[model samples]
Target: MSKTILITGVGKRVGFYLAQHLSKSGYQVIGTYRTPRPELQQLEALEVQLLQCDFYDIQQTEQLIAKIKANNSSLRGIIHNASDWLPDSDSACSISTIEKMIRIHASTPYALNLALAPLLQNNPLQFSDIIHITDYVVDKGSKKHAAYAASKAALQNLTLSFAAKYAPKIKVNSIAPAMLMFNPDDDDNYKTKALNKALIKQEGGEAEALRAVNYLLDSGYTTGQTLKIDGGRHLV
Candidate 1:
């Protein structure tokens, strides 16, 4: 029987590519998106199920897990790719904005994992996995983007906590990626500068992200570890 995987915020970019690639790899994919996007119709046409659930809403998060559980289907894995990148101006860096960032990036995943722990434990499959997509900036710490970095740092800690608690049954890992698929229309100079910072001196793409996921899934002995797909960005 084919395994089922749920990918949150899979309407575009890395999340979308993950859903598409995993589906092609023979896993049944259920993708969640906040707003309906026409591009996702292609995934639906390919028989990938699409569900609308806003991670920002706690009640909706619970309902989404409940609906999946009611189907009597066991989830093979979950990829938390949902994230918000709201830029904060000098005046707008208030408590509310920080709270929102924490709620969306850190709290939501933590809550969802707690709520779904029983379902994960009940899976008949002996091996299961969870991949949390985090940003490379968490370690470097962006000067202007403090909230985003702080939230992701908290998330990184949460990933460690979950992995330690869940143990040998459920493997939890994280992928920290840098400069993957920026706006196509942007000039090459910016891209070059970004690439130069990496040890590989080349910008990464969707394939690197997929590789991290595949590694985590295949490496049964690995947990509580983060695979950085940043082309050595942290080296500089």
Candidate 2:
């Protein structure tokens, strides 16, 4: 049987593309989306098992973990690709918003890894991988989305810690992308401003991110690393 992979936040964008990529690549994919979207509807057409879990809701998050435990699915990898990317002003990034960001990004990944270790541990392949979808702001900081950036930074740090603890049995890593996808509502001026951060003068879309995921899954010796597919945007 092909390896089983779980990718969270598959309603659209990178998570959506990654699910299609993995399913096409022959891995059995299980996707989680907070709400149904057209992309997820397509995934369902491809037979990707879909689960609804709003990580912002503690009860729903707990229930998702329970569902995983009940399935006892032989999962080979999990990609933490969920986030709340609402535009936040100084007044908007309230304590509750910050807490939700932390919970959705850091707390959920930690819980899933801890809860699912046993399935990965006992796998006949003897190894498993976990990938977190982080962002470029985690490298350079963000004024507008400080809460989101800070929470992702925490997740990046956890990637290091968990990679060590799970070593020889599981590998933990992250992919930090810059402008992986621009909001369709973004105007030409906004796109220009966003592209200015990249030395490559262009955005690397879901394809680059997918490449990193495939590498992490197939590379035997890589762990505890963050693959920044940011078009060298961190240089600035």
Candidate 3:
């Protein structure tokens, strides 16, 4: 039987690409999108089951898990790929805004893992994995992007915490990517500065991030590790 994997935020960008890649590789994909996106239609056409989840509301986390449980589908893996990014400027970094960031990056994923532990363990296949999509700046901290950085840092720690709690049964890990894709409105100077930070001196691209997902899904012995797909940006 083909196995199903749940990937959140598959409406566009990294999530969309990852879902596309995994679907092609033959893992049945159950993807979640917060809003309507053209990519969601494409995913549906590709036979990927779509779930609409708004992570900003904590209540929706349980609602989403309940829906998944009701489906009675066994998950082979769960990729917490849904994330919200806001530069920490005057426009951002407010208490309410930071709270939303924490909910999306840390609380929601934490709740989903705990709530769905049973389904993940029921996998007759080798090891079911949970991969949290975190940020590379987590270790480095951010003066400007405080809200985004701090919330994702919490998730980075949760990856380790869950790894220990669910060890030897379900594997939990993370992927932290740097400059995987240029932001839509970024100028040439902005792009150049971002690229120059990486020792590899290039964007990691969607493939680099997707490859890490494939690794966690395939490896039985790996857990509690956050693979950096940052083109050596972590070194700087």
Top candidate on lDDT is 3
By summed lDDT, the worst window of 10 consecutive residues in model 2 runs over 85-94
How far residue 85's Cα lies from its native spot in candidate 2, in Å, is 1.5
lDDT of 2 by residue, 92-156 (tens): 44877788888998999988888888877766686799898888889778877888999999999
lDDT of 3 at 46: 87
- Of 1 and 2, the candidate ranking higher by TM-score: 2
Model 3 Cα lDDT, one tens digit per residue, 1-236:
32788899999998999898899889888999999977687888889989888998767777889999988547788999898877665654477778888989998988899888888888888788999999888988888888999999999999999999998889999998888888789999998898889899887789888888888888989999989888887677
Error of 2 at 197 (Å): 1.6
Error of 2 at 194 (Å): 1.4
Clash count, predicted structure 3: 0
Per-candidate Cα lDDT values, in order, are 0.84, 0.86, 0.87
Model 3 misplacement above 4 A: 89-93
Residue 165 CA displacement from its true place in model 2, Å:
0.7
Number of clashing pairs per prediction, in order: 0, 0, 0
lDDT of 1 by residue, 45-114 (tens): 7688898998777889888878877764567888989988866666755776777788878888888788
Model 2 earns a TM-score of 0.95
TM-score of 3: 0.95
By TM-score rank, best first, the candidates go 2, 3, 1
